[model samples]
Target: MATLILVRHGRSTANTSGVLAGRTPGVLLDERGAAQAAELPARLAGLPIAAAVSSPLERCRETLRPLLDARPGLALHTDERISECDYGDWSGRKLAELTEDPLMEVVQQHPSAAAFPGGESMPAMQRRAVEAVREWNARVEAEHGPDAVFVMCSHGDIIKSVVADALGMHLDLFQRISVEPCSLTAIRYTRLRPFLMRLGETGDFGSLAPRPAKESGADDGRAVVGGGAGAP
Candidate 1:
């Protein structure tokens, strides 16, 4: 029952503008973002966090800082392997505003074969992130029992990809789960199989309170998040 607590970073400046922000540096959380970070620590009040691993990005580090402040014993480590997929030239571009291109259409239809014009492919991102998570779990299981809890803080897209991999999801329908600024997702591991106990939800963080989601076009966490967007 080792608990793996996955977190998406707080609201970033890029998030406010809907930019790609792939592997970009210096994207700190907005004023609201800092507030969100301060609120999440209460969510893990008494749990033994064991280790606080981040995606080696500034925003991810910012997200984990509060948790570390509350729980002094929790070790903080960085792993580039868990960072967000490189959006390449798409970095900083609004997905909604991107020109309609044939390759974009191809990837929308054939995910494994599609690649962002200047970024990593979905399959590639998935492959490495999955491995990083697997290794993180192994270390925790080795030291703490399999029932121990391990915390990971990362980007929305990366967290979404990792969640999908653990639950067997696909490319599209990613919005099914809104990895809100400073949100948490829980997954349990038995032997080698991963079982999701929770998706993106504001459960309990130390001092952080999740921001309210938009009214319309919000994700339902019913599809594309795990077990594929359309899986039953």
Candidate 2:
């Protein structure tokens, strides 16, 4: 088995704008996100990342650019399954606006049953994402050896779903997990079960501080359709 490192793409324009970028076109990383991506190589200095995979979106590609430059020989492959959920008609809408949509409640409390108006269901998204990771895990292990580690740059929702599958948590509870922009989540897979070695290592301890009740519960149990803007 191989270790899988999941890297959510750096914050994007849509993130800062409070919109669900989904698979929307032209949503590239914002200035802060570009800086975050630039710092990735130094952050992952010692890992022997065997293979690199990314969502086809521009932001994911941009996030991996610096890392790829540092390891010029590492091949970069794009996997649509790891792309942001096909938000379809909801793609470019503001999150605040969507909060009023009736579907928002289902997405927050019962994601396994939520389906986007014109896009894919939450369950469908999880299935494809989990399958992609499982397939890639075997491929990397077979080709590179048991100790090999591979990285995949994907989206917030996609990463959460993969993490849930790895943790054996039900999809309905996946919203409880959060991975900030450019955060690294590592999972080691074995014959029997997978172990989550690291979860959302952004190297920032600010999140550990207690949050004010108002700010914390306002969005409690809600899955930020697209990962919300990370730290101020």
Regions of model 1 farther than 4 Å from truth: 99-109, 171-175, 203-232
Q: Write one digit per residue (lDDT tens) for candidate 1, span 1-232.
A: 5788888887777776656577888878777777778988887777777788898889879888988888877789999888977867767676445534565555445556767776788788878887988898988889887668888987766777778777777755444545666778988877767898887776544223333433111233222211110100
* lDDT (0 to 1) per candidate: 0.70, 0.90
Compose the digit string of candidate 2's lDDT tens values, residues 163-189: 999899999999889888999999999
Backbone steric clashes in candidate 2, count = 0
TM-score of each: 0.82, 0.95
Global Cα RMSD, each model: 5.8, 1.7
Give the C-alpha lDDT of model 2.
Answer: 0.90
Worst 10 residues of 2 by lDDT: 213-222
Error of 2 at 187 (Å): 0.6
TM-score of 1: 0.82
